[model samples]
Target: MFDSLNGNQLKKESVMLKKASIALMIVFLMVSVCSARVVDGVDMPETLQVGDAILVLNGVGTRTIAFVIKPYVGGLYLKNAETDAKKIMMADETMAIRLNIISSTGRGTMMNALRKGLRSSLDAMGGDFEMIRTRFDAFQEFFPEDKFEEGNFVDFAYLPGEGLKVYKNDGFVGLIEGIDFKQAFFGIWLNEPSPADSDLKTAMIAGDVSGEARAAQGQWLAKVDLEQEKKAAEAEAAALAKAAAEARAKEEAEQKRLAEEKAKAEAEAKKLAAAKPAPAKPVPAAAPAKAAAPAAATAVATMPAAANNALVAAFLVNAIKTSEQIAVQQGKPFDADAETRRILDMWSKIKAEVAK
Candidate 1:
């Protein structure tokens, strides 16, 4: 049939086919743009530009607490759309997870949720916990603020060789390096027995971009209980009060302990003081004695009057005894008067010497 056709017909047919192809492509593009996946009324773009790579939307879901408190719309973007959870999680390719916060989610809550989920995911995957935890802690540091407000888009974009880059809206937060970390982080959403909601995990992997799914998600997300919000606020306030009171009590207890320790130390010091011995009083030195005299007369002169008298008496007694012994040997009765006279003379001489 082609051999029978003329050149013009061939050219015309070629032009028509090209036009049809272009029209089909245009329609397809329009449908793609118009059928943007909506999660909780937020239109999630089909493609995301991360670094130098353009990523297609793999799945979309909402993070909720008890299926009522819708906090954020989570969308996974990859270089290729994949439904296989493990494959996507383990792949070291350019991918991203966009979290469009639709409610007032506290930073602490999100951080805790992420840490718990990522750790559980890594645990199930079975790998080095220290490495996982180190990276996980680093990832948590990206969010330093208190709360992710409504309309905040927090993105975790994984660059092939550059690790995971985090962004808040238009601002670049920080990066966590390593493929091991990236795998565990992605596993939080894709791992089996994941910490995320079952339905949410399914939606993220399967990516059901249907009107029904969107409508239901939006309606469910829109259901906000004012009483619940108020109660949560009151509860938060109460917790803050309790923490403050506990801190005060702890400080007071510490102060009391210090005071008691000081008092005990002082008491110990006083007891030690009382048990100590007193110092002895100083003694006065004695006066040195005078040098003795050389001669007997000089000695008698220096002596006290009573001492001199006693010495003279002792000499006189000795002389008298000697005289009596001499007389007994040679008729002492005949020499009594003579002896008395001699003794008298000697006494007089001794008295004179003592006076001198």
Candidate 2:
């Protein structure tokens, strides 16, 4: 039905449709990007200037209610990627943390978590909680505006000589003075004890650096220790190999002795049989002389039994001699009672092979 349309008309329509679609995609991506700071949902700037010092986004994380309810988007900002939390805490360089409030409940809950994190950090630093009690009491003055509501952004900016600068929605709030305060407050999110905020710390350390670069910085000591462990393992393996070789040699000697004993027993049995005088008897007229055959059959039947006894005797002697040494290879004391029956069974198989 549309074949009647001009070629130019069709081309123009197609171009308009493509442009509209592209426009819509751009709008969606913009909305998504804004909602998610840095990425989507983490509202953070690549470089946020604090006083005279310009800082880069270290990482972005979300603080949730019961791990599901969205509360606030937290961001850690530093000069660059820093895997070590201690360096962040000790570094007098400018760094900032932002908590972008997403919900009304973020005020009380998120703040409480922050306070608890700071206290835990303080405890880790070995400071008396009461000594810093007043610092926190005075620190509560920043929240006086009752507008700790949604869409509010709070920043904790640290300057070397001036201490921490608190800001709300871009307006200057107040200052929490002292180097000790910075260590404890930063530690809350940067160190342990804040399981909920650990993700934020991780994101900050990761920054935009490659994984290999971060691992190199993080695992230098561990790599040194790993080399030591490898050397120790090699030495232990060489010792075990030496012990196993000695065991095999001892086992070979025992087997040779057993074979010699079996030969000796067989020879001695045959000699004794030959030395014994045969009793003479008159043969019956009807019966064929089978006396020589009976004697030969008797010797053959007894040969297997004698060989079996010799093998069993040799195995037992070896077991007794090597039990303690075998235990050393096992890295424990040898249990003679448990192994005796097993050795006997093995001896029986060897004897059976000889009989066959």
Candidate 3:
């Protein structure tokens, strides 16, 4: 079913298809080049004329907030590309920091960010810090009373004698006069060790980012992570120390509790003793006849004066003992062991008084 074309027809068709493909590719490349040069919807001029000198676009980047919202896109222009921030600030050549506002509601936020940036940059230079802060505070008044809306352009340009010229959307906002102030102002977005500024400064310095700048950036990130780990370790140690102290307190409390319990047990034993009734007096033994000479003499000699009233009783106990012995011998009430123990207990009490 092939309506077979000639070899010449097939060759011409293939060539036409290839030409169409090439045309499309060329158009796509052109579009990409055009768009790539534009920054944050604002097209940057290749050269910017400030006063008499022309500054070139050294680098461009977005100022992102919280890694999500972009409040502005910033571009740095310089007479010559310089990666060292101090050199850029002190070059005594014309340079500009251009910002295209992308968020209308972030004027206060932007101001705070600028203040923080200025502080960060000023911290690097160790002289007249209070003067530097005062200068930047005055510089803040140059902004419009109304918060900056989207699409507004703020440009800061520095010339040797003219100082820092401020322009808002191509209109004049006035200038702060001094190279000293210029260095601190530009530092806000050009200094190192900053989360945003370092990257932006590096990109701005070299139109095409170099490996050296990236390396510095890598080291900064590593330092940040290291500091975070150190803080985490300190916090963990604090928690452990607190726990150990709590355990020691609990152990001491338990020991005290056991001591109190032992004291209570001793008090209870004393109370039980105090509650007991006194013993009843023993009954007097039966009366007896006068004994033999040996027994009488021993009783009179060993007896105490305290037992003067009990002599009769002691003699009666001896009589009872004799009766018990007689009863045992006659087998009438034969408990010899009990009878002897009773006689010994009675005699021992009387003897204890005598010894005392």
Candidate 4:
């Protein structure tokens, strides 16, 4: 009976240890699964407890909103709709939501409507602005009287009730009510002459000739004065012609003087030739006995072997000196003795061949 009691106590202790090991394994598995999962917007692991706050991603396209959780709300609330509801119940979660994008077509329609409303408002103002009136006056002043029709000036004068319309680039600017020729002249600083008023047209045409047109006519007269300049040019040309005649006369005189001098030189040359003495013909004569005697004495004096060699040496030396003198005159240097010997050898060989 005591052994049976001890065995039952050992079995109960073994079962308790097994239960503890299973509980530890289940805790480790839970931890491992929580650590492996990533919470993107929350920036925390799924291991977050029920009280831990975290962020979450929301919105579309490139935009995102981060929502923070309170102690009651956690990253686990994003797991499902039921958890989301629990998060809403537990904490106040505000989201930065974006409105829809506005398209170009919608913007264009709005801009057109704004422009139309602005134009209507401006028109309702009756153009009382001083700047607008001044601009209109400037535009009306731009159109001159010559631009109007032939009988329009008369019509404008007769119909004083009619308004004068002003335009800029063919766009309506404003109107000038009740204007006369004098008022128009005051505005534009020019008189509008009517065709029906012949006296005014004649006076205007004549006055134009007296005013700015007179200055233009004066310029024309100045141009006509250029014709008178031709007389001065002709006078200058005539003076040149007289000077040329004098120059021609002077040149002829110089030519005549040169001809006279040349003729005189030729006459003097002819006179000198006629007066010169004739050259006498040279006649061959026999050499004197004294000259022959001296040549014989020279030959006899050079007859000895040493004397002949000395004579030949002296002759060669003289020949070399002459050749060196010629070389010096030609801007060159020559070896006197060597050149003389070379020339003597060449002469000797030529003489020997001739003799053979």
Candidate 5:
């Protein structure tokens, strides 16, 4: 009894020890997880007015951050903050202007996050992130102005062999030898020329050149010749219509000829059907022969054995011929005589009974 009691106490102690060890392990794991460091920093104003510098724990390793002073809520506000802070502030003020720092680390982190998020979002949106970046880059290069506005007309003329001339108000601004508008606006940074000054230059040189003498001459000649060409096209169309009508009439005559031939063939088929003999009917069983006459004698009297055998053979041949006719009618070819001979041999055994 004492030994059993001691064994029970030992088991209880073992279980308690296991629970304590498990609890200690769990605590250690939680502490280790809590001690890990993440990317942590404070959000501060990105830009400051003249003589104003905001101190921010710069995750990008920048010491001082500058900001532009802008009016907000009837008071002066600073612009050019970190993206996170800007997003939070802009959530309330929809019309607020914010400047992006565009640093290497900042852009990289933001772009990585954007890519990860867009992988799922892009499927729903039906576009790729790479395409979105490419389009954004193109938009920045093409139209650099903050807001688009209408400008005066600028005349750009390309000579036959000479370079292109840009004009504003009858004054020549510049000459371009080989410039492509699509490449200038849509090409990558390494290949495309800067467009910052191009817009301004184009705006200044608007409405400069008069119409070219050669261009005016070509336009007038094209207009006069176009009317004459239209009249010629109408005459040609009329001639074509007459020829088409003649061809249609010929086609109708040919169709009528084919119809008459088909009717004649059908009538010949009906005449042949009428001339063909009808199939022979099977004979009914004869009444019992006279009592005095033997069965064999009576059979011989009703039909000669040789002739009866021949008639059975003929009937079998007719059956095979009918089968062949059915196959032929169904667009299949068959050997009628070979099948008829096969049927005669098969019915030879039954010929004696049939003759009787």
Candidate 6:
């Protein structure tokens, strides 16, 4: 191809190619510097005009679920580029947040997400609960449609003095008046607790729309924290169980000690009783009073020694019966019945010997 061109023709062709190359470079630079960011296949403009205020795109992020479901692409537009989320939320200047619904999101689902975010935002702001609730209730009416399908645009533009204006698919929804509401509403994404997705929050703050926020590892640390909490709970439970077991063991040991003390006391009592001397048996009482005193004396004088012994034994038996009654009333630990039987047997033997 070069051989077909003459020397002059080659020079002209070379100049044309250089000019074309420079123009292409200029075009590329312009496009790079002023191009719209594409996030999750949604085009986010570099600048947004809201109520005569021009806001620049600070960043773009995609709201994802488990790193798989991409619901919407959120673009943050501010008066100036900012990396700090707190500053952005606190600033009262004109700013706008654009949400391009890339998937089917129902009105209920969107409102629920907003409610969670706003709650966190309001809590962070520490504003009046009733006032914030009132504003939030009014804000709920902004999303009157049942569902915001794919290719829908939801824009929340905050004007410093006028409050926050909402638009659904470029159609005006409603306005909620209050800087307090704005602080809480934006805090859903910029707040520390993260009402929606933390990874998306980071991306929006960083001004990058690389889809890295949707990565699986984005929530890895959260999972790690949960696992750590679970382990701590299990450890606490195990410690409680061990404490209970130890208490039971201690109780059982004390009970065993008490039982041993009781048995030892009983044994000592038995030993003391065994070592003590036995009491003498009682003598029998005299015969019945039906006999006269002189006759009793004569009978005693004429009676054999065995008969006298029987008479004493009878008296002893009568004494023992009275003592048994006293012992019963006093709750004494004495065998009164056995002692009576022994005395009776002795008397009978004495009587029988006397007759023989």
Query: Which model, 3 or 5, shows the larger TM-score?
Result: 3
lDDT (CA) for every model shown? 0.70, 0.65, 0.66, 0.36, 0.36, 0.72
Candidate 3 regions exceeding 4 Å error are 1-36, 208-356
lDDT of 5 by residue, 38-95 (tens): 1113122221111121111111111122333211101111212232321222222111
Expressed as tens digits, the lDDT of each residue in 1-356 for candidate 4 is 43455455545545554554555454444333222222222222222111121112111111111333111101111111221211222222221111111111233342333233323323333322232444344544544433332111110111224444433323444444533321322211112222212232222122111122233333333433433443444455455556656667887899999999999999999999999999988887977644222222233333323426677667655656666766676667677666755656654655566679
**Predicted structure 5, TM vs. truth:** 0.19
Task: Please report, as a residue range, the 10-residue window in candidate 1 with the lowest summed lDDT.
Answer: 217-226
Off by over 4 Å in 6: 1-34, 207-356
Which residue pairs show collisions in model 3?
59-204
What is the overall TM-score of model 1 with all chains considered together? 0.48
TM-score, every prediction: 0.48, 0.46, 0.46, 0.20, 0.19, 0.48
Q: Is candidate 5 or candidate 6 better by lDDT?
A: 6
TM-score, prediction 6: 0.48
Task: Flag the better candidate by TM-score, 4 or 5.
Answer: 4
Which should have the higher TM-score, number 5 or number 6? 6
> Which stretches of model 2 miss by more than 4 angstroms?
1-36, 39-42, 193-196, 209-356
Judge candidate 3 at residue 264 and give its lDDT. Answer: 96
* Candidate 6 local lDDT, 272-309, one digit each (tens): 99999999899899777662232223333433454476
TM-score of candidate 2 on Cα atoms, chains taken together: 0.46
Q: Compose the digit string of candidate 2's lDDT tens values, residues 1-356.
A: 12223334445545554554555454444322112244334446655668755456667777655667777777777766777877887688789988887776634655677677877887777776677678787787778655468777889999989989999888998898888888888888776644346666677666664343333323432433444454454555455555556667887899999999999999999999999998989776786644332222222333335546676466465654465554565566666655565555555665678779
At residue 99, candidate 1 shows an lDDT of 87
Candidate 1 Cα deviation (angstroms), residue 91? 0.3
